[model samples]
Target: MFKIGWLRIANGLIYLYILAPLAVVIISSFHPGEYLIFPPQGFSWRWYEHVLMSGRYTEPFWNSVKIAVVTTCFSLPIGTLAAYALTRYDFRFKNAVQSLFLSPLVIPTLLFGIGLLIMFSALGVKMYFTRLVLAHIVLTIPYVVRTMLASFSQINRSIEEASVVLGASPARTFWLVTLPQVKSALAASAFISLVMSFDELVVALFLTGPGLNTLPIMIYSDIQFNLSPSIAAISSLVIVATLAIGALLIIFMQQRTRKSTDIEDPKP
Candidate 1:
């Protein structure tokens, strides 16, 4: 009983640590004053209005959406291929190839961004929206690959063999048999890639110049020049948006899991 009490206390503390900052930010965002203050003097939606009215904030928000969408689109196919190769096939240098594909996750983001900027400059590639999209895709691929690989690992290989024995081509077998098994993982991976690309700041900061600021970059610049409740308002908005996406993904994956279980075990 004493050990259980200590464990509960520790868990409660950890939860508090995680939620304290978010609670503070959400409260600060409602401050009636122009600048941020804890235990706000008054409460109002004026800051939210300011965030909505600001072109600087809205433009970058849109840019973040475009970049995240493009990043997911590009990353999904490449990551899925890499995951399939890693999980399903035997090949020379397989470990090396997997490590190389996942290297971005291990490397420091700032260093990676600097190297990319230098390399792109040398290649005469300008830092623009398309380039930013490509960079985000590179950064987000590892998450998709890792998640999909986990999903693929859990699948039974004999299903593929059974399909082939039934006269299905390898491609047909994969499309008809393997894909349904791993669909939940793909959905989860895509959501993760989308979130990672959307919330990314370091690479975006280095790559984005004038006319290409993402929402995070805009928030960074705004904080640098001024400290306002509106910044908190923007942060709150982003936090809510991201949480909504995450919750939807979780709900989707749960439904998929239930459906997969039902397919696996039918009742008479």
Candidate 2:
């Protein structure tokens, strides 16, 4: 009984620690005052109205979405292929190569940002969108690779072989047999990559050019120069978007699972 009581207390504390900031942010976003404050003065949607009507936050938010979408597209294929190579092929320096690809995850992000800036400068690459997309892809690929590696590991090799033996081409076998098994993992990786790329600011800071500011950059700038509650409104919108994405992914995966299970167990 004592142990159970202590465990509940610890769990409650953990919940508080995790949710306290979010609760504060949600509550403060509705503050009627010009400045951000916890235990908000009063409820109002003026800040949200400003965000929707003014192009300031909306532009940067759209920029973030565009970059994150492109990054996710590139990261999915590259990371999945790298993961497949590591899992399905036996070659020299495999472990080394994997480590090299995953090195960014271990290295300091600030250092990576600096290195990318220097590399771009040395290469005379001054294009803003190009640099931003490339940097975001680099940052996001590791997430996909990590998820793919785990996804591929759990796949049944015999099922793949059987597909190939039963007149399916290698590409067909992968698409029809191997791919569906890991669809959930791919979705999860895409989510992670999208979220990370969307929120990424450190590398973006070094690479962003004129008119290329992302949402986080905008928020950071706003916080530095002003104490407007508009920041809170924008942040709340982001939180809502994230929650909506999470809900959609969960629903998608559940439906996929149900279909897969239905296919396996036919009823008359």
Please write out the lDDT profile of model 2 over residues 83-183, one tens digit for every residue.
98899999999999999888889988899989999999899988877798898888888888999999899877999999989999988988899888999
Q: Could you give candidate 1's per-residue lDDT for residues 13-37 as a string of tens digits?
A: 9999999999888899999986678
What candidate 2 gets wrong by more than 4 Å, as runs, is: 255-268
- Candidate 1's C-alpha lDDT? 0.88
Task: Indicate the TM-score of model 2.
Answer: 0.93
Q: Considering only N, C-alpha and C atoms within 3 Å, which residue pairs clash in candidate 2?
A: none
Q: Give the Å shift of residue 120 in candidate 2.
A: 1.1
Winner by lDDT:
2
Q: Can you give the lDDT of residue 89 in candidate 2?
A: 92
- Give stretches of model 1 more than 4 Å off: 266-268
Clashes of 2: 0
